[model samples]
Target: MKKLLAMLLVICSTASAEIQPEPIGRIQTLPDPYPPHWIVAVDVAFFHMNDGKLIVLDADSDDPAGRFKGMMNGTFIPVMYMAETRPEIYVLESFRARGHRGERTDVMTIYDKTTLAPIDEVVIPAKRVSAMPTEYYLQLVDDEKLALIYNFTPATTVSVVDLEKREFLGEVPIPGCSLIYPLAGRAFASLCGDGKLLTIQLDRNGKLVSSERTEAFFDADNDPLMEKPAIIDGIAYFPTFLGNVFPVDLSGSAPVIGESWSLVEGVEGGWRPGGIVLAQGDASGRLYVLMHPDGHDGTHKDPGSEVWVFDPQTKQRVDRIELALPAITMGLTNDDDPLLVTTNINLEVDVYNANSGEHLRTIGNFGQETVFLFHSDR
Candidate 1:
């Protein structure tokens, strides 16, 4: 019996060694510029902040394995931005020499879009915001020639770097404002604490040329607008805590504040916009907002159960998409036919047809926390 068992085991091991994978040392690469329908979901990994990840999924495919493009590391609550002209992905991240307790170093790591590998890194200030990552934090302005990194050490300031020269230019102090809103030519704006927009203009050398603030646009104490906005063709559509859209035209040197409109007129259930990513826009110039029922104080950060679609031109609710699951974060691709990407209540990623308002499928949870979604061709 022992001899027979030995013989069987030897035969099984010999057979397994005979069949080997055919491909030998072949590396796979993604397209130079990713498809416009691709979605990049950023996971902050609250359980373990040191191991953050940025997952890329193909929204056009329903297959679990087939739609997964690839992923890259987003160490330490990194903020991401996709480059339009270059085939590069920029991540503003921080590192500690002792794995969480040493001299902290922050850098702008430039990754190759094709290989999904870090190609170069430009060192910046160590004061990058360590809180929740948002779309307006690290913005590329000045025709994508300059990169602005938002910093907060209990005080607000912006660090400007010349991406073309790969050098840190200087820091601009924005003491009372928050978030970066790119303006026309060498300028950007931020929302002030007093319900106003402060515009900052810079020169070719990245030095501050002028700064101005608009009159109180909205009542900050009573009704505050969500800093996140859907920017379409240089117009920012920002939603208030209640359900109103405030349009700001950023096509000129200074921001032109347009009239505000209500989105929940005649609608029921007390629907109001709320979520980490409150609003997004599709390629057809339509606005999509995450909404929840029975909204109240402190409910502004709650996950939304429905998505309200509206025509920016008409400012009317065209369609409302009932979410398959409550979503905490949301994003939309910039394609003609777009896919609504979101991180649901269970931390899972869900895809829906933007035009038809159909629940496509859920991609399952990729990490402990996915707070932001980035969309673009690159």
Candidate 2:
């Protein structure tokens, strides 16, 4: 009887410890009913500058799917999304061991898409440019094989990283130039301070194969091109501050400067180009330019009240989109029915039909100030 009681007690103890699995505190993921097209907005809080975040929103529903914060070292840094490869996002940021006064460690952190967790990180030896955030600061080249990150410690240089090998190769000096535009193969073009284009060709090992400079293309001081250009089929359409469209051919070995044309014709009160995303290109080779009336000097960064769609082939304004709110940046999805998305100064994202220019919806009071808007389809 004593043995029977002991065995029964052991069984009861085991049964008590094995509690029934409850639905509470369990992990579950429902199907994503939203469309695949995504809009990545880098929100750099002007007031709370240290609390910057990369917010990814579904273009179809205007719902945020993920948010990445505290990775940018309390500064506004550029982040690139790699959709073609193993599905990861790359951020060019700095880290200091002993706070702001310590030696800075420039690194690129790769985050997983599903969990938004850091999967890999590679240290960049060269100091990266930490001025205003621009997409040209970091770009993936050769079908996502190499990542070329621009560095500017007052002197221009590019840090090359082999993404496939997951290693930093080296830095290439680009004197008297700023910004990067990836050309055919492993070559890239930079905008020179003296109104010229500098093209640098690199071998697989990140060594300089050839470097060339074009003639002074645009007036850098009077009418400069915006850092962000609309690239389509190895051609970059640069919009000048005074509403001029400049195209540069990057298909060949050397840079070819195409004819420059004005975006506005005989407008009343000085219509000029303005906004963070001054211009964007669609898959059909149409260029979308943001325009503001009564623009003056130092007004290049102002919000645009109108969006003009133009065809680069014909150089004509095909359609005009009257924005419901003034936009500081704009992006477009590349789906069958493309959506023109714009972020206003009020930190709200306005979605519109790309073809009809009809207002679709407004999303976000998410308590973040957005600086740049990028489309996943790009």
lDDT of 2 by residue, 1-378 (tens): 999999999999999999798787754322222244565567666555445666666656634434222122224355555445666678776766664547778888886655556678889974898766767888877778888999989888999999888899999999999988877788889999899889998889887888888889789999988878888677888999889989898776566889998898766768888888878877777889888998989999899998999988898999999999999988887665778888887878888888899998887765556656564534
Candidate 1 clashes between residue pairs 3 or more apart in a chain or in different chains: none
lDDT of 2: 0.77
How do the residues 1-378 of candidate 1 rate in per-residue lDDT, one tens digit apiece?
999999999999999889677987888789967877777778888778888888777877777777778888988987888888888889988999999899999999998888889998889889898987788998888789999888888699899988888888988999799889998888999999999999999998889999899999999988899999988888999999998889999888899999999989888888889998879988889999999999999898899999999999998889999999999989998888888988889888888998888998888744436556655573
List TM-score per model, in order.
Answer: 0.92, 0.86
Model 1 regions more than 4 Å off: 1-24, 365-371
| CA error at residue 41 for candidate 1, angstroms | 1.0
When summed lDDT is taken over every stretch of 10 residues in candidate 2, the lowest stretch is 65-74
Off by over 4 Å in 2: 1-34, 62-75
Clashing pairs in 2: none
